[model samples]
Target chain A: MSWLHIFFALILLPAVAVGMIRILKGPTAADRMMTAQLFGTCGVAILLLLGAGMANPVLIDIALVFALLSALSTLTFVRRTWQPGKKKHDDPLS
Target chain B: MTILYHSGTFFIGIGLLFFLSGTVGLIRFPDIYTRLHALTKADNIGLGFVVCGLSLQSGNWAVIVKLLLIWLLVLIASSASCHLIASSGMEKKIKPWTRP
Candidate 1:
């Protein structure tokens, strides 16, 4: 039912919020980045469920965009912000 | 008709379980590699289940196809990013956590 879709969508919010702890305490940049990746996937799922529950087709398109943008964000982080064997703050171009 | 609805709910429930377990793993795992293993695998499976469930509930074929496409994109992106993160961690000389 529509309520089921909404329920699923709401439950996932806490999961994503809990994931943020990794970003706070993550020992390394990669660890933090992992949480971001998790966000991307979770976000897509949430949007999908919400779209179904609300009967709004446009939300699905937004979810698709969310998927692509999250991936792009991770790629940029890995290539530009993360420098292996060195502190990220030390990078000049980052 | 009712059976299809119930089954769809069942799949979504399973997907939620996977998502929870994956989050637990992300929190409890000892190392980056292990966390990545937990996350990339579990979450993708979870998303797949969710997609499957939503598609079952949906009457339109186009929505179903769109859902599947989103799942595939997330799958590919998550795995690739997982690999990139793991490799970069290795390059950084971060040692894996062994039982201590």
Candidate 2:
């Protein structure tokens, strides 16, 4: 059973790694913010898999904390960086 | 018992496949909104499967509830964060990607 779980972990970690590529060179800060969500969700899976594979139940609780707090960074990023659109019209007289 | 474990493995495999597709979409999609759409949808579904798969091995109600809770929280976070990012992008006037 543990071996089967270990197999799952091996595949799941790479999924997180693939998401990281976007974080490294994504076009904007918002794009990078998506990475935070990816990490949170993926982290939960990996932690659970690790917990199951190792027979360590604590990891699942840790994963629960990870899931609960996943949105914090994205909210902070959007508040800090994203500005409201300004309305401006080009005027010929200026 | 063996059949149950095998079924669980099958679900996990499918979840991983979706995770792969989501990452691919993230890379290939034209812009942030599209990437957000692809990832939030794909990853949530993937997590759903993974959680179900894990729950198969959970002999106790507490473990099942804990697994479900984690997936539920992730689902909410994914949708809410997607909204926050997309709205913020719109606020900042990050133009939506359009195909020529």
Candidate 3:
């Protein structure tokens, strides 16, 4: 059963990896941040599977933290980082 | 008991499929608005399925509750953040993609 749990966890890795490509190719800051959002949810799923696989409930606590922090991060990104009336061209690299 | 385990595994598999589709949409969608749609909706559902699958396999009541709570949190957070991102993008005058 642990192996089954671990196998499911392993499968989610590619989803996160593929999302990274979007970060690289993203034309806007929000695009890159969206990848970060993807990471948050994927990370939560991975952590949950690992918790079940290892029989460590502590990881569930960590998964909870992951969920909260991801929300806060995105909230900050929108309110502070992605300011209103700011031109999209304000990004230096793009 | 074995039936429960197999069903849990099936749910997890379905969850993984949702996750895969969400990732594909995030990567392939033409605009931020469309991508936000993909990320928020699909990913939250995927997380909910995973939580359900895990809770089904878990014997502990506390863990099951926690898992459900986490799902609720992610659902609320993702949707709120999605709205924020879309509105922010609009404020910056970012246009939606049109079919060519």
Q: Where does the lowest 10-residue lDDT sum fall in candidate 2 chain A? A: A85-94
Indicate which candidate wins on TM-score. 3
TM values, all candidates:
0.92, 0.89, 0.93
What is the per-residue lDDT of model 1 for residues A1-94, given as tens digits with 9 covering 90 to 100? 4888999999999889999999999888888988988898889999999998999999999999999999898878887788634445543333
> Which segments of model 1 are wrong by more than 4 Å?
A84-94
Clashing pairs in 1: none
Top model by lDDT, which number? 3
Alpha-carbon interface RMSD for all candidates, in angstroms: 2.7, 5.5, 3.9
Once superposed on the true structure, which residue ranges of model 3 sit more than 4 Å away at CA? A84-94
Q: For model 1 chain B, give the 10-residue run with minimal summed lDDT.
A: B83-92
Give model 1's DockQ, 2 decimals. Answer: 0.54
Model 2 agreement with the true structure over B8-83: per-residue lDDT tens digits: 7788888878877888888778899999998899989988888888788666689989899888888877887788
lDDT of 2 by residue, A1-94 (tens): 4987888878877777878888888779777778777788778888888888898999999998888777766665655555433323441211
Clashing pairs in 2: none
Ranking by lDDT: 3, 1, 2
All candidates: TM-score of chain A: 0.84, 0.77, 0.87
**Model 2 ranges with Cα > 4 A deviation:** A83-94
